[model samples]
Target chain A: MSNFINQILQSEKTLAFPIMTHPGIEALGKTVREAVSDGEIHYQAIKYISEHFDTIACTSIMDLTVEAEAFGAIINLPEHEVPSVTGRLVNDLKSVGSLEVPTLDKGRIPQYLLANKLAAENIRSKPVFSGCIGPFSLAGRLYDMSEILMDIYIEPDVVNQLLEKCTEFLVNYCRALKATGTTGVIIAEPAAGLLSDDDCMMYSTVFVKQIVDAVQDDNFTVILHNCGNTGHCTNAMIASGARALHFGNAINMEDVLKQCPENVVVIGNLNPVGVFKQGTESSVRKATQKLMTETAGYKNFVISSGCDLPPFVPEENIRVFLETVKSNNV
Target chain B: MSSELLTKLSECVEFGKINLASPYPPQMKGLPGADEITKEALESGVTPGEILNDALISAMNKVGQKFSENKIFVPQMLLSAKAMGASMIHLKPFFANGSVQRKGVFILGTVFGDLHDIGKNLFGMMVEGAGWEVIDLGIDVKIEKFVEAVKQNPTAVVGISALLTTTMVNMKPVIEAIKAISPDTKVIVGGAPLSSDFAAQIGADGYGKNPQEGIVWLDKLTA
Candidate 1:
């Protein structure tokens, strides 16, 4: 692993979702979704965020949609809120085959790539892990989610073809990301969590392994995130060869962490919504401390939000979370 | 023969056999499905109430319980829901003719600023299968819209869902506004972001971890 990966391995820290958007919505007086589309604002937000928490990530705002939008999926962008994929672009084998993988400049991808490069060049102390969606998740966005699940059973060849194309684009995207002097990439495949372990292995894990092999090494690590799996497919997720694993609030973090290889890093899974954005300061601190106590035995464990913390999460709550982690070092 | 029809209809729903034309489940391929059996029941002089309470609701309850217990999943529950919907098509006319009754109405939606609806749709379908008239407001519904829906539906139990942490906080206000206008309207809350503790904290009447649990709550509420 790279020195950055090696460093994170040495120390326990609180790493989480978009800090720029959290402050952008609360302090900067701009909509985070809109701000993230602009690389300069995204960099500034990360810079502003770095002062608060070390080992912060580049703006992971809507990492789920960039690939789908690039593949010509219609996106519904609301000014002050998260963007969503509106219509499915792939319906059948012909449609999946007709999909043309767009260049790096397609949609708002370059902005994210730019933000990663800028953050890496500026922030010299800690790691700047960039975020991207995984192949199964990107494919799920391009087609109907439920249909894709059923299709995996009935139309395996078509789904595999779509996954191949998705993985091809992701491999290219990760290569471009690695060239940007970033520390690592977190490939989020939350949609694959909805599948059975066998299906997840066949469809999600194998495809993610291809990307991991292509992009990851001792110099650059791959962190696999599956908020959807809820520990049901934890074994399949670990087998993807991602150096780090991040889970969601659907399953207990302590239990999930136990399933990880002893050497691998485990990050998770405070309730980003119920406990972070919506919780009071005392409650946030209590939840974080409780989680720390629960997972205290796992030295490989790193405390993090179960998923991305939403915008306008009270600055106080954020402070308590960071402080709770810092004060209670294992 | 009549009891046999009811058992067959229930079996069709329980097994998620949509129709004779549906080729799913492999072994049940060529057999008549929920739609075919429900129609046969009606023609053979089975009452709509018996068909609903005995076969349809029973089948859905088993599905719901299985879902809660992790015996089946979303895809399977959805298949069962599609089968139930197919049967409901033939039975809907009986309600208009005053031969059948509904349990009560259920008003549900994903709260404002949240666009996710797959969970809401499933819950609505399950509640509908349980013999309640479900008024789904769809996603990104404002609190005023919820209040207005409560005003219109009056006695209907309200359910609110939010998939995001930001939008889940909005569930509190929707619950507040609906209760502010109609205190008797029991408001239920659920989502990936919400917990029973949060639901109780927000003054909601109950919380459903899954759609089946929501139906169980609604059944107890109207019971």
Candidate 2:
């Protein structure tokens, strides 16, 4: 249970899990439209990625809209791009009473679950982790983000009820993910990063703590991700009781490492959008080398992208990101 | 009392004291907030232009500076922007009647194939709070939309935002289209995937690291 996560965290070799799949899909000569729509192709993309990198774990696409869509939010899926929630599902609190926790079979949940199960069967080299939207972020999608923020001030009980519903769905979703034999789950909460520390603690972390307790253990752990959190909420995120904390490119990584508990694994945070997908091979190597040197002192720090890699990261840059991590041996 | 009220309005915008009714920040409950102070200033014989220039514009400039210095985060910025928005409801009529002149027009949007607009909205609000008319073309905006917009507002500065590296590259063509249509219009770029270097690489006249920096650059470009 603890084998892969422990080995990667404690070992002298730094690992690379760029939260990527577009590159792998492209490697298969398939478009993202095909991969995202088909579970088998998505798994094959993960398998292709496993053969190419020193990864702590292979992750499914961090599609933040899947759970929202399942919750009855309308989602817009472009032919070859990341899907986004189009409109609010629970627009009013009174309407929130009519909301029901969606069955796992609803929406694209089955496809993602099958993709995880297949990735677990095929990727023998490292642990496989499933990704899901975090509770507050899900609620943000269900009720538009800007409205939710104001609603918190104007309508506290309503926001609380919506978060309660989001957590219930996420808990069941993560358990189903655990049944897939993946090592753990990475719960992404980028939208929560938009909240203040206090607001995040109240609205995001408390719910995240519920999901973490429900899903994490020696065998399976929960990695809490918040790419939108620049700085103010790191304390609340650590307090949320997730076994691992994944940050994005916005904050200074070394500062995050300093505040984090040494026992917990701290994974991060290359700018996947800026450096990896956009940079050349030499540029990736230079950025990786610089970050490696900067955070070398931290024991639990695992080298990773700031957020999910875009659907078109260059192959050479991905290779250099992996190789640079391997050569550092920090 | 007039200067004091205007200064308080600026402070309210800075600390996100939205209204007398807003319970945030704890210490300022029942105290007049930006909404109250702006209304009070307007009724105290201060011209609508003075309120816009002396308080709202000055306050947003401070807010942008604080944002750049990491003195505040997005939530606070959002609150202040909301507060400014509440105050603007009072001053909007003056602008319509031509008593309050806008500094310039900024046409902004998220590039085509991108749906994310948090950054774009933030910049739009900040630029608007700085006394500019923000012509926001919503998400997934194409190059033709930009060129047509450029055709309408020939002298306007254009702002492009893209959260994904894939979509950020789309800015190059949009910039080209706008330039080809109106050679003098300057395009500024910013987002999660973008840096000053990328902005320059894409041939944008300017790169705003954040919403504040973007507003500051727009000020310089218009100047």
Candidate 3:
């Protein structure tokens, strides 16, 4: 296990590791587009958030589009919103064979790498984790999410071919992120959560495990983040051998904790939208305390937003969330 | 023979056997799939309504129930939908000639600023399979477009979807606009970020946690 995981496991206090960074654009006076596209702005946003919040680690923007964009997928960059892949790039087996594995220099990757490098250098107090879209999620973006889901059954070999290329690219990408002095990379595989447990094991877990094995060591870690899982594929996720598991708010954290091994750090599952972006300060406090109390018996539980905090999540709500977690320290 | 064909067709739809050539489900290999079975049922003098009600609708309901119970996930549900679509091709002519009647019209869309449509499309397919005429407006649907769709199909139930927390807030105005144009029109809202409380807060007539729940609400409306 990495020292990062060891520290989290040994800590008595419930740690806060919300997948946050976008809201720091509020202080930077920058739009979402500017922050995502520019390295300095992205670094500054992470810096600002880490300085303000007492988090165990600082995470980069959980933008799922950056790696897809690097793979030559057309991205829709909204000025104030997280970007999305507008359409698919590959549709057939021939195209999958022809798809190129991009280098770190491709499409805003350098910018993201620079952001993480800067965060690693500057944020000395806490571990800095860079974020990337997981292999299956990136492949889904390249082949279209709906189309790929059906393709998994219709053309298993073709989907496997595409997944091989995706896994290859991600292994290299995570290696590059590791070279940037960051502590680890959080592979966001929300797309795989749409699969049944067996299918998830076949198409997602196998590839994620490959990446986990390729880049993870004592000095670095792999944290698997799946916001789309509804409790069906927790075993598949655990089998990936990631050092930590991060969940979204779609399932009950207590149930997931029961399925998880006590030594592996299990982080997550406060509703980022319902309780943070849309709820009142009192609601944030109540939700945080409720989650903490529900999983209070588990030593490995970490209190966090179920997913990345959206751009306009109220600052007061975030403040209340942190304060509540701190005040109710186990 | 006709009843056997209908049973076979329903099994094809439930198991996602698209056609004879499809290699899925491993055990069902070399047998006819939904496409061929549906055609054989029609040629053997099975009524179109029987094929639809007994095969397509019955199979899709099982798919929905399995989905709601987590016995299956999206990939399996979508394959079942594809199989149903194959059978529906044989039944479309009957609907056009008024030999068969649909339950009602359901107008669906993902609200503006949200491009996610996996949920919307799945629900649309399920509704279509359940004998409802579905007018899917696609993603990033503006409020005016929804109001216009409601204006055309005034009695139709409106189902709006938004997958993002940031975009789900957009559901409020779209629901309000549809209600303004047709107050009696029932509007249902769904998405990852939505809740029953959020649906009521936004004046939605109902909230569907999944496509099956949405179908249940739609069935209750006409029942």
Candidate 4:
């Protein structure tokens, strides 16, 4: 039986699995023996995930700074690391007035589109997720964080104005990526958790609702991902119109499961460093077993890390997670 | 602002009022937010040290407690921080003159291979709000930078954050490096990939489940 199917059978004692790795794809080099090096790192991520596990996707590191870069912010692309913006786009609130929704073809948008297209072809029959930076996170990237927060108070109108444009860009980008044949899109909104419940409803949820509403369809699903403590914003995320939610390690998986609507799927609560990066395979397997048992019998759950996998995590541990799950099949 | 006004300003901060002109919770809109009250206290002859200690520090302590309990979200805490920041602007001269005392120093950064920092930044701000002087190293930080920071600060607490699973592993050696240099320096670890067990394994002195928890741990260490 497939390891993934065995996991579904609920007989596995362990269920640790590796999260996607973006840079590892680049390490494959240009050798023909490494057939995985067919396209960008994101596509290679899809191929790698599909070959090893039940699900397939990239965490979208084509450059975390892509949108910010396109927004005319100065970006620092270190040779060995993912790109980041050095400063904010709206250094002054006056700059926000000039900003507009960028074309999807601009910046690294083409890279995502192409990656999604390739993932669609390589990850046949498996769920392929294309991720986009949610409006608020992108806004922080475009504008320096300090300035953004200051603007939130001194010029909320400008913040709102920028949010609308950012939302438009993200929605269009999500739709375009979805059209590339992805099963879903993961909206990475690490910044939304920073808002109060009302602000979440007003700024975060309001914009996200518009995006989800604009992208509604059976062909694609929206998975909300916030890599911050999101317990306060979980309901707001649900209200924002996502079908699933992915959270950081700080969140209580049990609490999230209990609080979220029954139909809302929950993926992950693994200690990425504790188990996947540092612990032994046995430890990882045990943790997965514990997690599965903790939230047992709920179809709304998927075994995943609390967040993205660390690059140096041993692949053997991942193999062990799959093996343990497969071995447990009833 | 008189000492009495400073005391009142602190109350405004403790409850989270951005400025005297703002009305968030609606009860204190026109009465005076942290901004106006703090300024008023300063003008009314309140010493900067009194404002920093009695008003700003005390208010942030309440904000931190509320945050740890989940009674507040990022926006509320941020508002409190903003209020604190606005008030701190007036106290900068006092710090320069040695009239106000900062608790200690903290050097914070996201671990290598991790690109996310919203959590890391929030923790830095919160720690700063708690009266510690913070030197933010920003995201995708390397181990050497931390070593250098520890070398400079000597007694400064080192904090490492990583929001990505892929990047969290890099923290292990970073933590080890700090201990190698200054074993006495407290090492606090947080982020999405870490937990208490992981923190223990990494030999970190403490692990915060959230930014507020980090501040609490730091305060306890200094206390």
Candidate 5:
């Protein structure tokens, strides 16, 4: 096991850390309205988390929006918050045709690469996983969803063409991030679960396979995380070549583990809001214990939230998560 | 249409037989599906109300109830909704002509800062199946958009879904915005990172832990 995973196992409590540091902006940490003001503030946030937690993860908030924004999608940034694209991509497939592969130096993508490196280097050996958005999610952000959905019938060719572009950008971005020396990558695929089995196989799986295949190296783990109830796509997700699949707790854990490939690690399923965000520390500990027991003797697994830990989640709850894992060793 | 025909229609819906063109659920492959059955009922002088009540609505209700009890999930509910939608098109004229009345009105969206929408989409279809007219504002809906929706449709119940904790906080403003526009408009919230207490704390009128719960609450309000 990696030292980071060992610390989690050795800790007397449930171990918890964030995936990204808030450099003010959701991505890049540049001045996009509510950006992190400057790099110093972002550094302080990292320092604070590292000083307190057993581990620290990089903070790259808007990694998902970078490629879409570069692709002529008008992204609006609310002051001190993450940026969001203005409209769905279906309104103008022609515009996507004009889109270029985003260079690392051009937009916030490079800064995220920097942030991950800094977090990894600063935290030294503490595990720092770079959370990247899925191709489908970035495509959803770039275009109008209603149009893309309709294109599934009226103009599947157009949808395929656009997805091709998205896949290119996503693969390139993942490759660039992988080159940066971050411990691993977490591909967030919230939109993949929205599609039917056929649509998911066609639209999501191929791109995911490309990214995972492109980023895999002996040094880093490429984790794929999808939030919400993904009971239907569990098997397909494992087949997408992700080393680990992080999904929400709403799904039956046993069912998911059963579908997982032996080499594929399973992470996550804590109810982020309901249990971690709302419950007391003891309850969080108990929940973590239950998850650990369920996965007893499973070598390739990690305890984590079914999704992102809500920012306002209680610190004590995090401690309990680490404690539960420690107190109950497999 | 004969009672036997209606029964077949209900079965198609229960089994999620969308249209003649679909070949899913292999047992029903090459068989007449929801589309053919609904169109046949219309041609046979079946009242839209009977086809809707005895066939489409009942099947969807069963799906919704089953989902509430965890017997089925999003994919099944989605298929059932597709079947219901196929039948609904045949009854559109009835709705337009006021021969058939929708149960109520619902306004739903994913809150700002959250772009995820599977939950919202599921809720929209499930609630629509439960007999309400749904106005989906879509994802990343701002507080102003919600306020405008509430102002434009004063009687519509509001629903907000957020998958991110950062975005779930936005639900509060949407609920407050709707309340500010029309306090009488009921507001319900759900998402991965939300709880009933969070919903209540945000001043929402109700909280649905799942899509089916949202339907049950909407049904109660309309009833």
Candidate 6:
């Protein structure tokens, strides 16, 4: 086990590791566009959120579009909303064969790496886990999600070839992130959750396992995150060999914990959008307390937002969530 | 022989076998897929309506049920949709003329500010397979677009989708705008972050947890 996971296991208090960075934009009075495009701004957002909130780790923004943008996919960066891939870069086997694996200097890769470096150097109180899109998710972005799903059956070889390229790029990217003095990365593979368990193992986890083997170590951990999963692909997620598995609120947290081993740390799954962004402060407290009470028996369970807390989530709701979890002793 | 061929066509769609050349389900490889069997069934004196009701809709019903039960996922669903699509190509002319009629019109779109459309597309496809005429407004659909669609097809049912918590809030005003224009239009809301309570709070007539659930509600309306 990595030192990060060991520390988490040794800690008596159930920790909070919400995938958040948008709240800091409010603190810095910066637009979402500026924070996502500039490394210094992104690092400042992480730092501000870390200093203000009592979380187990300082996690970078979970931007799924950065890697796709690096691969030349068009992106739409809304002023207050998270960026998204607007157009696909690869459409056919010919395009897939000619697609280039972008260098570390491409697109927003440098900005994210700098943010992790700064956060690792400055945030001594907690580990800094950088975020990146998983291989299948990246390939889906480049090839188009619906197209890839159909191609996975109709053109299996083409999909596998594209996945191989995606995995190659991710391994290199993970290595670069590790060199930034960060503890590990949360590879967001929500796209994999859309597949059946067997297909997920064949198309997503096999490649993700390659990345885990390449970069994961005692000093570096990998937390596999899949917000789109609805309890169908939990075993496939476990097969990725990530030290920790983070799930979205689409499934019951207790059901997932039952399927997981006690040694591998399991974190998740308060609804970030429903409870944190839209629900009342009172609702947030109830939801958090409910989750904590349900998972109290599992030593490896850690409380967290199911996915990233989107922009403009109420501060009072986040406060209520953290306060409830802190007050509830396992 | 005709019934057996229809059974083959239905199996092709249920298993996502697109055509003979498609290599999807390993067991079904080298056999006739939805395309070949659908065409063959037509030439063998199978009426387009019989093919429509007995094969395509029947297969999609099972697909939707499996999806709701979590027995299948998106890839399988997409394959089944593609197979159904392949069969639909042969039946379009019959519907274009006076030989057959669709159930009703379903206007669909992802709410504005939310570009995610996978869920919307799946719902649209399932509704289409279930014999409804779907007018897709695509992603990032504006309020006016939906209101205008409702105005044009006043008697049509409307389905709005959103994948983000931020965008799900937008469903309320869109629903309100549609209701104001066409007070009798049955509006349905769906997506990942939605709940039955949220749907009711937002004044949506119904909420579909999955595409299958939405199809069930739509079928009930026509029934």
Cα distance off (Å), candidate 6, residue B200: 1.8
| Rank by lDDT (best first) | 3, 6, 2, 1, 4, 5
* Per-residue lDDT of candidate 2, residues A1-330 (tens digit): 355557756777666667887777888988776677688988998888888766667888878888988888888877677888886688786789789989999888899999999998888888888999998888888888877876677568899999999899999999999999999999999888878788889999999999988988888988899998898899989988988889998888899989898877888888886788778888899999998888987878888998888887778887888888888873
* Candidate 3 error regions (>4 Å): none
**Candidate lDDT values, in order:** 0.81, 0.85, 0.91, 0.71, 0.70, 0.91
How good is chain A of candidate 6, measured by TM-score? 0.98
CA shift at A292, candidate 4, in angstroms?
A: 1.4
Clashing pairs in 3: none
Per-residue lDDT of candidate 6, residues A29-110 (tens digit): 9999999999999999999998999888879988999988888899999888889898778888898999898888889989
Give the root-mean-square deviation of each candidate in angstroms: 2.8, 2.1, 1.1, 4.9, 5.1, 1.4
CAPRI band for model 5: acceptable
TM-score of each: 0.91, 0.94, 0.98, 0.83, 0.77, 0.97
The order by descending DockQ is 3, 6, 2, 4, 1, 5
**Residue-by-residue lDDT tens digits, candidate 4, A38-121:** 346667755766666543344444345667666777765444344567755675557787887788767666776887888876
Question: For candidate 1, what's the TM-score of chain A, rounded to 2 decimals?
Answer: 0.94
Off by over 4 Å in 1: A1-5, A10-21, A24-27, A56-59, A154-158, B143-148
Docking class of 1: acceptable
Tens-place lDDT per residue, model 4, B106-177, is 999989866667677778878877888889998878999999999999989999998655566688899989
- The better-scoring model by lDDT among 3 and 5 is 3
Candidates 1 and 4, the one with greater DockQ: 4
How well is each residue in A216-247 modelled by candidate 3, as lDDT tens digits?
99999899999889999999999999989999
Worst 10 residues of 2 chain A by lDDT: A1-10
For candidate 1, lDDT tens digit of each residue in A185-282?
A: 88989888877777789999999999999989887888888988766789999999998888888888877876887778888888777787789999
Worst 10 residues of 6 chain A by lDDT: A321-330
Where model 5 places Cα greater than 4 Å from the true spot, the runs are A1-48, A56-62, A91-99, A120-122, A145-156, A195-201, A258-262, A323-330, B1-44, B62-97, B107-122, B135-160, B163-187, B200-206, B220-223
Model 6 sits at a Cα RMSD from the real structure of 1.4
